[model samples]
Target: MQLNAREETPVVSVWMITYNHEKFIRQSIESVLMQKTNFPIELVIGEDCSTDGTRKIIEELEQKYPQVIKPVYHKSNVGAARNAYEFCLPKLKGKYVACLEGDDYWMDPFKLQKQVDFLEANPDYILSFHDCKVVDRDNKVLKEGRLAENFKKDLPQESIILGSLIPTNTVLFRNRVITCPKEIFSVTNNDTFLFALLGQHGKAKFSNDVQPSAYRVHDGGIWSSIDNLEKRKSGLNTYEQLYKVIDSKYKHLIKKALFTRRLMLIKQNKSVLDSIKYYINSYNYFYFGNGMYKTWLKSHYDLLKQLYRN
Candidate 1:
């Protein structure tokens, strides 16, 4: 899409959440500034307390560009969960709120424009997200597509329930349709919770294009920065929490994802009967887990395996 540089820019509230992203924050902000669209932007920098010098750089940028950049700086290090809940949501003031975390950047100059144009034209969709380039700390390209790249026309509701989001940065949601309730973010994994909430109310749009935004994965990444033991335990805990927050409307999709997880876990641990039990009886266990469901699942799995093999 060819956008004229002199065109008037729409008022987009760029929501950027940052922790200790001193290495990539500057490039991230610069990517926003390089957009071809002519629109007044209110850059909302939600600074989760970083021990590193990230806050200082944001302060410097804000001071240098007084009109465009505004900050929501916290005194202490509020983790990612609390930061999104308390700092960013309340400060969001644009008709179209575009999220770009401090660690990620916009690769396409027309990205904001393409998304804004679609949202403005198609008023039905309350939320929209796109594919982003996966990069490393040194700005090396790891992958070229995003979560929804597989779904160009309509993202399967099943996929949304999978809760495998590309990155928070690739999303640009309408503020009118959704807001981060403090209750929602207080959970273990806030991002998926927020996305699923949007799914509950109205339709969401996803772009299948090759490159939309840039997501930098590094040693300091949200999940990678942790120690080995804690990472393993925390990941499983986060998964369970996400399984809890998923809205009821997409229960089936969530159930499918759960089944897939069960199968994978069983294969890894070599628990065949346990896997079958988890997969088949997830509907019964959706509200709460039960031992009876496990027995039923084992019987069902054995019968199916015998039938197929025979």
Candidate 2:
């Protein structure tokens, strides 16, 4: 059965999670409003109490665009993690969701339109994310392409199983992909964790054909933005936190981490395959990676033990 691109269009909730993003909120809001899709879009933004005029900005936009904008402004600053995960959960009422942070704006109006068209056509696939061009606070293009090369080939199921696949800003997840109840929203980037879990349950998809959105790499981004060192350091810290969250799968991650690190080394004209050969061989039931990770784990435990002893 051939699918008409527009007929089975899914309802996409444009989730704009904000904290202290007064400067970029306007562009972000405007971006959601600019979508050229046939499906309905619900803009659910949690205006975490911003010290700046961001809340007033949201209010002004809400006044101007009453129908599209649906905001739950916090009386007090509730922090980004909670404001986004907890406060924004109740507000979402769509078949699928497209997450764009308040600090970043979508460059293409057809971003949601194109993604829904692809997802509806491909029923087996769970989530779809487009490559983003890095942009700055002034909306200036910082880099012409992706932050780093992720999923060199078209996305594979095992890749989703093993690889790190949450580029949260550009991703769109179907309601079916997210099985967690309302309470799961409090789980960190619960949206992100759900998407990866979705891939585990079903097939994950990707589009390498075109760049459908502009992912702004401002200072306050979830991941490392090239412009800021402190935020980038925090980003790495956040990455490690997520790392420890997935610590049970530490063995598998040791393989994946080494694999990607080797891939990067291959790009850099250095020999990494030989260096990380022990970890890579662990996938063949060798557990060499486990041996290495255990050493590090033991060292960490021993350090903690010394603190306790003292």
Quantify all predictions' global Cα lDDT against the true fold: 0.66, 0.61
Number of the top lDDT candidate: 1
Q: Give the TM-scores of the predictions, in the order they appear.
A: 0.74, 0.67
RMSD of each: 6.4, 8.9
Model 2 ranges with Cα > 4 A deviation? 1-10, 147-153, 177-192, 209-212, 225-310
- Residue range 268-302, candidate 1, lDDT tens digits: 33345554554555444343234445644554565
Give the worst 10-residue stretch by lDDT in candidate 2: 262-271
| Candidate 1 displacement at residue 234 in angstroms | 6.9
The residue pairs in collision within model 1 are: 8-38, 9-38, 9-39, 10-39
